[model samples]
Target chain A: MSSDILNQLKDVVLEFDIENAEAVAKKAVEAGVSPLKAAAALTGAIREVGDKFGKGEFFLPDLVCAAEVLKKALPVINSAIEKNGEKANKSLGKVIIGTVYGDVHSIGKGMVATLLYVAGFEVIDLGINVKGEDFLNAIKENNPDILAMSALLTTTAAEQKNVVEGLKKEGIRDNVKVIVGGSPINQEFADSIGADGYGATAPEGVKIAKKLLGIS
Target chain B: MQKGFKRKFEPIKILSSSQIEQIHSASLQVLEEVGFRYDSDKALKLLQSNGCAVDYETKIAKIPPDLIEESIIKTPSSFMVRSRDPEKSIRLGGNTLYFMNSAGARYCDVDTGIVTMPTLEQNNEGVIVSDALDTVNVFPSYTPYFEIKGVPPVMSCPVSCAQRMRFSTKPSRGAQPTDTFIWETQMAQAVDAQLMGCVEGAAPLSLAEDACNAAFYYLDAGFPIYIASGSIMGGSHPITVAGASVSHNAELLAIVVLLQCIRPGCGIIANNFVSAMNMATGDLNFGTVAVALHQMAYNQIWHSLYKIPINNTGSAFSNSKKIDYQTAAEKLPLAMCSALSGANLIVLHGGVTGELAYNPILAVIDDDVASTIGRIVEGFDINDATLDIDTIKEVGSTGTFLSTKQTRTLWKTEDYMPRVFDKTSYQEWLAGGQKTVIEKAKERMIDILANHKPRPLADEQDREINKILSEATKYYKKKGLI
Candidate 1:
């Protein structure tokens, strides 16, 4: 019965059904199933969705939907695992992603967040038009392993450097790795701003996240 | 007042008539079978009520060919765009051609080649330069590369529009009609000059909410809407130029149909900013021969069949991050093809790479190119005055006509003089400083900025425009946008 609940949970994620995925996750928890193992299966399912996306068989909306389902399912499983005196270590790492202030472009940041989540990272998406203070607060609260920022406009591209400088001023620069990206961003800009890495695309963003976390 | 040139000769056809037809039919099929998504509820409902099959959950609409055909018939082939000064206004069909500069270029890195946002003063200076160029029919909204000291982006539009109106009397091209400021800017423009609303169509056959709102607003306002559809090949479209053209046309036509539905006979200019994708870097390459081919194809097809004015980024919009050899090579062909393809309006002043940055010096250089292409497209006349058969006879074999009456009378009209081109011989050119084209362009830029005086807006009109801008800022601040 527990195995059946787990399989149902994974299927819900694969089908990108958010409500069902959450409900099935709760069912697996009620059935005394291993939450971490179920999460692993869901992660595997999300990875399959990413593979389909990379292969051009699926569009951005499809990948986004699948990620949303997995995102909804994760909390339910995490709470149940917490009740059992166990930690949810199924995540490869934690990341905080947002578009810098003065820029409201959301596509690039959302793409990176989705890809990173699919690559087994716990992503805290801060959305668009985020200020420098917000990045510092998110880093302080979440203590994430990576901080990814995107700026689509040249006007706001400088804010990426501002966020890094803010981190330095707060003495938290070494606590998290910084990744800057967007259509206007390049390696020179990234290095100028002292970013740890730069990703030109969503897939490349995932690779950068994994590399930063020392994951193969 | 310098009005732009008109093409008296035939446009070069890169694609045969049948190929254009096949592409059109294929696009209609794609619309009917594999409909694109529309992010606007208003558009979806409007299309559905108008005989389209719409899936509400996915917001996808499959439009029938009959509806598109019916809508196309209502669209006028030509219209006039008025300016504050009637003399500066332009007609938008036939062989008439116009040139305009770029708007909202955040950076001006001409000296150090280091990208940095421009200040409002620098932006104003750029406007002065654009006003001085005889080739640019209309000025563009001049925005600082960075945010102004106290103004938010949402409110920057009205300020920029007001500033441009104050400094230059030429009609200005509207910036990003997708923004809410476009509404505010239009409101400010209503009191004075006319603006051609710039609306971009989302690729892969979709129309997002902002784009839809912008299109509807301009069409409703009775202003000419410049509908630009940018399709990055292999990203949101097919890899091949022909296939990308098909997708680009579909996207443009879908919006055209919607515009016609909103208001039949509304003025619109079709623009396709198609480019290829660099697979290795995952970057959309704007400066490429393939992109030039796509621009030419779209220009020819739209002009030949639709019988309306077409806008193209033919002379500008490159992928080189810096102004270098690659930038020149890529921009030249695209601009030449655009002029030859009979594009009615081509954007001549723009960025070096991917429209991410702007350099006014490039505009000066491109102005020279526009002058040259203008002469080429004019095609030499066989009329007696131009043919000068009598003059040829008078001069004969080795005799000189250097002092002839014809030479003295028609010299200005007969020869195309470029402002930035080096006419001096090699030794004299070196003695004059051996300046590169960029350096010569800079000298002209400095001269224009220093001496050219744009016709100023009336004092009362200036006060009224500033009041409108202040109101817009207050409204946005109330909404907490600032």
Candidate 2:
């Protein structure tokens, strides 16, 4: 039984299957497998992916795929811990992430994603070409600790406000902290966009996320 | 301060959108009726297809305004001007401002200090790569200011430039091969084997009658040619500030129209510098206030006319000392005005002194200042949130605003904190180094040079560079460059 649980944790770490990570996780839970060990295994793998990104050994598609793979494994890994009465009911924190509309670029968002992961926060990325409604939904759904968005194009920076206004229309204003980022973006634009925080670089983004979450 | 701004300068006009439109219309009129002369036949063909009247006799093309505007929109507002030698490249039109030094030719000032007609060591070969890499904002071969070290050729040839770098012994001899159209029969290849390209400064040469014969050369061994035009008002331009700006604008406009006549999307920089030639001595004086105004006007007009991102030469001082009122006045206004005018670059900062006589230094303060100055130019956007009137009233204007969330948000993002000028009490100043900005800058220089590890070059490339610098060493030994 012990070996079976370990094997399931390993498979999840390997990202061998979409449903299998969750299914095997459930099986491990039934067998009374340790939740922390399971989490440690996946976190270790994800950390490797993150490091590889930092080292330039991996590209954007690899990052997106890895993020997706991690996404698949997270719930399963969490559910197993919940079953064992060690549920991560308290998350490190939450983040609402999106690409400002009109900007098809996603690398900045991806950097923020990896940074949030390394810093131990749950980030809900709304993906590229996302409009204000999408942000509203993510904020409403996740009730995240920080709302983050990025736009690479100068023309699309205006869309950042549209997202903020969208949040207002939905009556969820001021409930979540918004942090804005991108290449052309400055503190001025971020403030103008009504975001709570502005980070110039990816590392700074992590710092902002942690600070916003009251996580020091 | 904002209201008093007009009192000082009569409020230099910020051209309204309509005024911009008028300028564009005027430029188009110049292109179509006044006509631009071209050196290359291919450039002429490109212009003719795009609604330009091509006159083979003068190698000139007159383009319509709408067409030029259409072509301008296609030009990449942002681009990475790659360095073949330097491992890093700087992005033009990116929010980041790149820097280069004040590299125009040095002639005897006659008044303050004699410029002593600078030679190869003091000019192009000695200046190129180190000058490009020492600061930032990618510098093109200041065509005339090509090298500080020895290189074989500075002709309109790519192989020649590369060959020179490969043969030089200097630590920083390199070139990013750019396409330039020579006579109708020959063209310099692009640095990359795969891409055909051109830089903007070569416009004047490419838009001439000689370019016709070079056509077959480009067609066969063709590399993309980019042309750029530069005008230094006092040195080679009109004496009046506005007059100088107008001359440069006319030159740039003429050149681009010529290049567009040849190749529609040819990259260019509305690159121009307005330097004050000490009226008495004729030395390049950067601190003169008129040059700042000239640069500001030139940058704004170019942006308004082209809509293409511009790379303007900004702030530089001719003094050997890195910090002074000359440095302060010249560097500050040049940087600020360029930023306000949205210049993609301001090249001479950090370790640049004697009008760029010194390149390497131990201090990084200049670099720090340059970086801070760039961020300062980005400026603040004031809206309801920035005003935070409610927050202000609740906290009370007289009370401390430091503890507010807005303050916290702003303080974190503040790009500059002026430190060289001591603002502390006299006692505090005594406690620290009782030094002025120049002494502080010198100390900072020591710190940077002591800490930096120059980006390394490939062994083969290094060998080529060494061999070339050795030749320069010999040349200098004969001529005493060091």
Q: Which lDDT tens digits does candidate 2 get at residues B112-170?
A: 43334445543323333333233443333332243323333333233333332332212
What is the C-alpha lDDT profile of model 1 across A17-133, one tens digit per residue? Answer: 755777788788788889888877788788888998899776566677788788778888888778888887767899999999999887768888888888788889998899999
Question: What does candidate 1's lDDT look like per residue over B84-115, in tens digits?
Answer: 76777777767877876754346647666566
RMSD of 1: 33.2
Runs in model 1 with CA error above 4 Å? A1-216, B139-150, B176-190
After superposition, the stretches of candidate 2 with alpha carbons farther than 4 Å from their true spots are: A1-216, B1-13, B40-51, B54-58, B82-89, B94-96, B101-137, B140-227, B232-247, B261-267, B275-290, B317-323, B350-365, B380-412, B418-433, B460-482
| lDDT of the candidates, in the order given | 0.77, 0.54
Compare the candidates by DockQ and give the number of the best one.
Answer: 2
Model 1, residue A7: distance off in Å is 99
